[model samples]
Target chain A: DAGITQSPRHKVTETGTPVTLRCHQTENHRYMYWYRQDPGHGLRLIHYSYGVKDTDKGEVSDGYSVSRSKTEDFLLTLESATSSQTSVYFCAIRPQVYSGNTIYFGEGSWLTVV
Target chain B: DQQVKQNSPSLSVQEGRISILNCDYTNSMFDYFLWYKKYPAEGPTFLISISSIKDKNEDGRFTVFLNKSAKHLSLHIVPSQPGDSAVYFCAASSPGAGSYQLTFGKGTKLSVIP
Candidate 1:
């Protein structure tokens, strides 16, 4: 898993609730990303951080916000969870070296919203 | 509007036969491409990668071929094994985009029958 951990590996929540998923890495890599995987959608980047406190929106960034207050942690928060947001979330880290820009992925956090 | 696309939803191949997965992209600036394999309940894992500057990259039984002019790429696994059955995703990234964030396809599920 490339020394990456995603907290709350499985969670069931209600619609209109708030949820936050945490990603921690021991690699101390400068780049970290949050992605969601759903049927028919392999993986869509929700947000990414290039450095501490530097985050940017991705293709499916709507309703999702991310924060990186420290070098080892990147957090993704769903301000208001929706039924459509129920999916498997993955955290990834990229090594500084450009070994074909390879990125490593965590196990994944499955969230179900009712 | 997906920048990357994997047309096949699923593929079935005989054990010890050849397996080929295809992907296409619409972005002209994409300079890097990669293939990832995912099993049930696990995040996608990096399998192989290729740069736009090169046409082919080989690693063990996996070979990735890139055609920059057609904006397409494929992964060929010769003598495929049943253990290779999984969902395969094709991802792309542009170096000039400043961030190494990747765009991924819908993925193709591969089933290797014994």
Candidate 2:
């Protein structure tokens, strides 16, 4: 609840279609992260940004792209959605870039690709 | 290749009893760990965290124990209530350089039965 908001809280798209999820934060935290939560998969990091325009791929970065042109916004896009990509997406933020920093998350976006 | 692992997929505890969730990590380099809780349709919320420098940290009914030697961490929730039903994830991170990203476990779904 750290002033985070994820647009399109629910989205349903067909396979082969492009889908984008937006995460916005007012906390002005320097570290932002995009994660996907699937059954039996917990929460896997997909992409993260240390700063504006400074993004890095996570363990499950494949088939996904991220952009952070502004410090308050991070975007995750799937060029070609697949049924396997259906999952609840979460965006998290940390005030610092250290492991000890406390992280906050948005409400999340539920995406279903049929 | 999974640095953090939650071996238990689910757990059931009677209300007012204690609940324990376990997590393991394969990386000794991970200097810090965190526990997060999530209910369906909502994003994960930070529960408790402990650093490698400490063995235990407690907050209210939640306590986190970190055993660096075996690379294991556990979260204990006392007086579990029906509202405590949710999926809990154990996440780890190594401090240094430019990384605030956390590697999360698959998670354990805990149900507090009345």
RMSD of each: 0.9, 1.6
How far residue B66's Cα lies from its native spot in candidate 1, in Å, is 0.8
Global CA lDDT of candidate 1, please? Answer: 0.94
Off by over 4 Å in 1: none
Candidate whose lDDT is highest: 1
Candidate 2 chain A has its poorest 10 consecutive residues by lDDT at: A95-104
B-chain TM-scores per prediction: 0.97, 0.97
lDDT of each residue in A1-114, candidate 1, tens digit only: 588999999999999999999999987899999999999888998999999999999889999999999999999999999999999999999987666678889999999999
Model 1 residue A77 distance off true place after TM-score fit, in angstroms: 0.6
In Å, residue A60's CA in model 2 sits off its true spot by: 0.9
DockQ of each: 0.85, 0.76
Model 2, residue B39: C-alpha shift (Å):
0.8
Per-model TM-score on C-alpha atoms: 0.97, 0.95
Cα lDDT for residue B94, candidate 1? 94
Q: Model 2, B112: alpha-carbon shift in Å?
A: 1.0
